[model samples]
Target: MKIDEIDIRQGTANTPQRSHGNCLPYVGVPFGMNYFSVQTNGAAGAWFFQPDSPRFEGIRLTHQPSPWIGDYNHLLLTAIQWDDATQKPDLAGNYRPTEATFNAHHLALFDDHFNVQTDLIPTAYGAALNYDFQQLELAHHGVAIQLPDEGRFEFTATGLKLAVSDYHGGEDQNLTMFFELSIPNFDAENSGYYDAQNHWHTATNGTGKPLTLLLATTAATVACQLATSYVSAEQATLNLQRLQTSTSATLKNESADAWNDYLGRISVRDHHPAVVQTFYTCLYRLFLFPQRCYELDANQQPVHYDTMAKTVKTGRLYTNNGFWDTSKTVYSLFSILAPELLPKFLRGFLTSYQETGFLPRWLAPDERGMMPGNLVDSVIAEAAQKGLATELMPALLAAMQDSDSKSAISERYGRQGSADYDKFGYIPADNYSESVNWTQDYSYSDYCIGQVAQTLDQPAVAEKYWQLSKRYLNLLDPATGFLRPKTSDGKFKPNFVPDRWGTDYTEGSAWQNSYSAFHDIDGLIAAMGGKDRFDAQLTALCNAKPTYHVGGYEMVIHEMSELAAVDYGQLAISNQPSFHLPYLFDYSGHPEKTQVTVKQLRKLFNASTTGFPGDEDNGSMAGWFIFACLGFYPVCPADAEYALGIPAFDQVTLHLADHDLTLTTANNHEHNNFVQSLCVDGEPFDAVTISHQQLMTSARLETRLGLVPNH
Candidate 1:
């Protein structure tokens, strides 16, 4: 049957003027089972249409409503019984798609009339089906299903082909299809999902429907045609090639391969599955951004960003925006492995700076300005020290200068090396205290910049910043050893309670922030008067049993305040400040403590859904998990060394660009959480600090396990 004309409307009462964006058309044999539907007006209502099908004899179409908050407001459907003789549709007792049957994006339904309807709607930007679906077919951008009366069908697209031998049987029916779509100038609103308002509109109003249908049909066909056509020669060849390319390209960068393999070895060699998963997952997250922008042209030279722009953009095109939290793990991971991309990554940051003057705090699609810290300096310094060329140094230096001269938030917090910075290394709580965490954040940023200078070999500058890093010491209450907020005149904030919310900090308390001294451990230890006192304070902080009123923000505060909880002891395991604190015991000359604490943290936290103790922080916390599981922790964010923790896996093999690295654990198990002995590349090792260069070269290490030490 020819599809002469089709129209879709958002409202039931009044039909709006026919716009090109509201119409869609499809043509094929009336296979009696094919269907189509769409939700407009931001998922307010779903309109369904189906042909006919004998297989769907007992099925009828039913609509499922979405609840508030979780309510997608998009199209949803079910299947019911069909009366062939009477051509009647029964809705009372209908079968529904299993909960896992449909992704949040689409709904499925079948009726006794042998008809089915599949919901199609966009959820990101602003929810609206703003494309002319019929135009999609004419442009050769969508699939064509050819169904014969004998219950056989063939589906084909730009570069895909498939055929269904017998689709009439239930569950036993075989189907196949090939699919491809050369989607040009295609872009989706925010990860192809809608935000709170249930909108799916795009910024530039690009032709989204074409790309959406093309990709959706491709994916859906894979599920339906899985049994038969999926293993066909054409399909097998495509799949194999894709896999080979992915694996080969990943191992192309020798340094990246080495670092990745080293991380894998630490986890597997230690016999730690949790560590392996978390570590590999963290590594995966790091690759999600600062994407490899240079696509190989016919000659294989770096080409422009592979978008519709058609412009020859150089360097790497990395994108995931986790700058705020990455400094802890993700940043270090990239600096060590993909140092070649550092210049490009820095260039991207400069682009952001050029667009918004100040460097971004947390860059999303736009600059979110979230969190504190002029962390750019730390990244630059860390990258340069690790043999990464800072070609963007001139640009970054200029941005830092501009930031220093400005009297904005940075100046208010005494972040820029201004006159008041020495006297008040941090903005007193009284001076424009917004996010209560600012004081602690100020100290952290100072330490980061100081390390950056040190990495650059500017000792005088490094000394100045290093002293600033110890500014947290000034706020330390000699009575409590907790780093409480202080006034510019060197007085503690009276009536300040360490556990109270908001008053002392954001998301955490003084008890948690007390451990924010990772950047200057020696100085902190000295200030507290030696390893014994330092160890005692740490023990008290970890052992102190405390309950907190987490209330509505339970997810945020509970993990931070409950010190007895393995996750809470080393400062909120959920927060950024405490990420490396568990490994600080190594610096205290008690490597065993570090091992014990690392194992406890991993055990208590890495369960199924609770795989994370706090905000994943765009994989920063995940990075910590990966590190601890692999038997080492960065300890110091800007440093090139990692303190040894207990390893987590039995064997891990990392495939790198140049060579391969392996790790194995002897007598490794959950009960054996302490390291009795260790060796790297067949050599004996006394303590656990691996150099940045060694980690990136791909090697093997083995660890012997033992029981935790008794006090």
Candidate 2:
């Protein structure tokens, strides 16, 4: 199948109360700096672009990672054909979403209310927009540009330049986005600025208003080039210059080629067409985030606006990703398929450390410090173990040590409750919300830091961190077989409710957060009992009721609803906490249970308008689906191995950087999801896990399936 055949809107059907991926129909190249999505209802706040809504507000150039994180540096572009001069310009129209084209590379929408059609295609830092007003009355055809908040606008010789200072907090309060747009030459009298009252003025520039630029053109169609920058207006102009000579057709082709290159990396041959479509669609979503926050100057040197220091700095930087989510799966997938990009991503993290003194936790243009732990350590560890980012690991390891030694002055930068965790060996429940999660995550991150240290040959430092990595054992409760939270006095918090959500856990209960000791699952199992007891507990976890108690939250959060929506018992694949739960059986010598559970989870996902079970959260869920279908999962990012599962596809060929690695399955059917045996290049293999080195070097892996458990 071709890239165009895949709909970018597969997981767009969503709401704040519940999510089907909770994604927007974003039209941009893979990892493009700017994404263009048609906003159907801007008044709905973050839930602005509904897939089925008939209302078409305008096309938005958005830097929104997730609705929960909110948007920054955004604006709306709308085409209008108004005959009246006295009326206020309304940024609303009606359009059929069914007829509109919403592909990854391009977006074309026909507004019936305005009798105009708009086409858009994106480059890395710029995009081309063409408005066709041939069906409108010849008397008037114009454009309305609206900024969500305070903005300054200047009419350029060719078109216009605007700077918006709008954000939903968590960055420099004075943060601004510089934008420039070049359009066909028009009459001087036809363009002006609108005041706060929506009244027009004949001024070349204006500021501090709900600013909207109105431009009337004589031509039947208007072609425009637009670019934005975090640096300055001069850099925005340079960004616009790259697209000056390119047309919509050329840009579309370029974007298509860019997306095809990434999506084509993994080819799956399945009897079901929808399965193939879903695989490619998930692959497309995988590369949309940790967006490029740096741009090039006249000499083509990388420079970025440092939000914390509030100054321009030299180096690559990235934003709009939460490390707690992506560290589990996103970077691991990159290790195999897009290994070439890992070095650059690692450098971005290094630049982040150099500027801010601590690596980012959640970067929406800058650190919001959402979630628990500095999970970017896992990202660095995985890269170092694979030898992808060797030059930067030493500096990054030093930065990790800094985080471990001291806490940050600002709560949004470094480890939370750092001093207490170091003193008590676990974050106390009475001191922090989600203390169990913070302790477990920090313990895993300690393991990751040790991995990087070992790779750098600092054995003493690695041993120190490796020993500290076992801190999760402090929270493990032998009675309930769950990791319970402890008070500041080092005693377990009283009244332990395993099914309670929030409070001591992050987005989940004890059942979901207990087995997160990624580097020490063996220790976790031994603490619980042995392999037999662990296997029984795993079975009980899968067979338990899908219920949740709103313990710490004021209301039922979307994650709780998503957990109850699915029928996988307590194994809530709707969120990141349960990503490795299916593979936990492998450690207990019950690989067949892992295989069956994974096969069952694969059926919940597809390439539909509502594709995902919950918040996709920057390709984390997509990575889970992709890995599960491919028959293995990155159970622990710091480790160099993948726990085996059942493959949904009959054949999958991974086009790696060095060579092709194909995975095939025999007797694989709907009911036959248990692996009886495995072979590597036709030689019998008996292992529950495969290493990164083995997968990269091997050419083919064959698995024979049966209906019953091999055990």
Candidate 3:
């Protein structure tokens, strides 16, 4: 299948209440600054879209990677029929989903209610939108530009310039979006401002109204070029001027060409198109996050607005990613296919450190401090291991250590409970939120920080963090075989409910959260009482009842509900915590068990509207799928070796930065699920683990398949 054949809506039909992919049907270039999607509902907060909805709210200009991370600096464009000159513009109309093209290059929505069609093609900084009419009788129509929150707009003969704020706008005066657009050069007589109450206003400064910019003439087609900036409205105008020459067709073709280039790199040949389609769809989603946020100056130097400082600064930056969510997968994928881009991302994090005096934990324009653990340490350390981003390693390492030494001035920038973790090995159960998972995550981050330290050849520094990483053992309860939360005085919590969700756990119960110490599973096994009991415990975790009691939350969040909805047992693949649970059996000498579960999971995902079992989370889950389907997975990001599993496809080839790496299986089929034998370059390969170096340099991997379990 070709890139254009791959539908962008494969996994995008979702609401916050329930998710197919928990993803937007985003139409933009890969890693674009903004993405455009049709809004099915304007009143809903982050869950504004449903692929099956008959309501067409408008076309949304969104910077939301996940509904959980609410969108910032957004606006919507709706075509209004303007039934009469005295009538107010209506922002919502009915449109059929069957009439729209929801894909990467083109997003076309036709409204039967208005007899108007809205078409859009996106660029990195902005997009080109075209409106087509069915009849000249409605030639007196206009466009309503709606802002969800308070904003200011100035309408022009060409288009409009406006400024809007992010979600956390009340306290954050720094977060201002400067946007400008160029269209049919409509004059003042055709444009007007209307408030949220539908009252036309003469002033453009207040927050009361949405701006209505009318067309120059009721032509058969109307077009516009929109540009957005974080720095100033002037740069937005400059961006519009820069891309003014490109037509909508030119942009649509260019966007498709760009996607074709990226998607074509990894080609899979299989008789089953559904399998192939699923592969490409997963590959497509892997590039949607860590969006480019900074803009370029006249001198071609990178510059960005400091949301924390509320001032303009000179440097490259990225936003809309949380390290806690991404550290386990996304950057590691970059290490393989797109190693060249790692240094630039690292530099962005370094600049983030320089500006804030601490590496960001989570940033959606700025620090939101959402998840537990400052897992950016894992990203830097993993990149350091790959020899990517070497130049920025020094500053990155300094920031890594800062998370260990000092707490942030605000809770959002650095590690939480750092002081408590330093004084006590684990946080007191009653003290912090999600203490057990936070303790485990911090311990792993310590090991990652040590990896960076060792790469810098500071053995003493490396040894220091390595020792701290093992402190997770302090909270391990030997009798119950769970890592329970501890008190400040070194005692376990009084009432321990193993199946209880979210008191000390992060979006998980005890079963899903434990066994996360990939750096040293051997040590963790010993702590839990040797490999036999550990293996049995792992087995019980999978076959045990998938039941939960909402202990902490007033209401069960979606993850808890989704986990119980499926019979995958405790494996909450709908979320990230249980991502590596199937692979954990390998550490206990049960590769066949891992093979069975992984193969079962491959069946759960397909290329369709409701494909993913859970939230994709900026391609982290997609990366996991890609790794699993390829027959190997990065079980530990800080570690360079991949734990071997069964490959889903007969032949998998990777066109990397330098060379091509291929994996081929003999006697391959759906039922022939177990690996019978393996060969690398025509020689039998015995080891279960392959180094990152071998994968990057080698050309082919040959493995034989058998119907029976190897165990």
Off-target runs (Cα >4 Å) in candidate 3 are 169-171, 202-216
Q: Which stretches of candidate 2 lie over 4 Å from their true place?
A: none
lDDT of 1 by residue, 104-197 (tens): 1233333213223322221111111111122122111112221221122122231222232322221123322222222222322111211123
> Which stretches of model 1 miss by more than 4 angstroms?
1-283, 290-320, 401-405, 409-423, 434-437, 454-459, 549-570, 605-610, 655-658, 708-711
Residue 90 in model 2: shift from native, Å?
2.8
Please provide TM-scores, in order, for all candidate models, with all chains considered together.
0.61, 0.98, 0.97
For residues 331-417, write the lDDT of model 3, one tens digit per residue: 888888888878988898888888877887787877777888888888888888888888888888988787567875666766677
lDDT of 2 by residue, 1-711 (tens): 557887888778888899989888888877778788999888888889888899998999998889998888799999887655456656689999889998888899899888888899888887898998858664667788898788998887788889999875755887899999887855446677677887878688889658777777777788988999989999999999877877678888989998889888888888877877888888888999889989989999999998878889898998888999999999999999899889998899888878878887998888888998889989988888888878888888898888666776677877889889999999998888999999998999899889999999999989989999999999988888899999999899888888899999999999999999989989889999999988988898899999989999868999989889888899999999999999999999999899999989988899887999999999999999999889899888788889999887889999988889999988978879789989998898889888988989999999889989877
Backbone clashes (count) for model 2: 0
| Backbone clash tally (model 1) | 40
lDDT of each: 0.45, 0.87, 0.81
Q: Residue-pair clashes per candidate, as listed? A: 40, 0, 2
Of the two candidates 2 and 3, the one with more favorable TM-score, higher being better, is 2
**Arranged by lDDT, best first:** 2, 3, 1
Model 2's alpha-carbon lDDT is 0.87
Q: 1 or 3, which is superior by TM-score?
A: 3
**What 10-residue stretch in candidate 2 is worst by lDDT?**
82-91
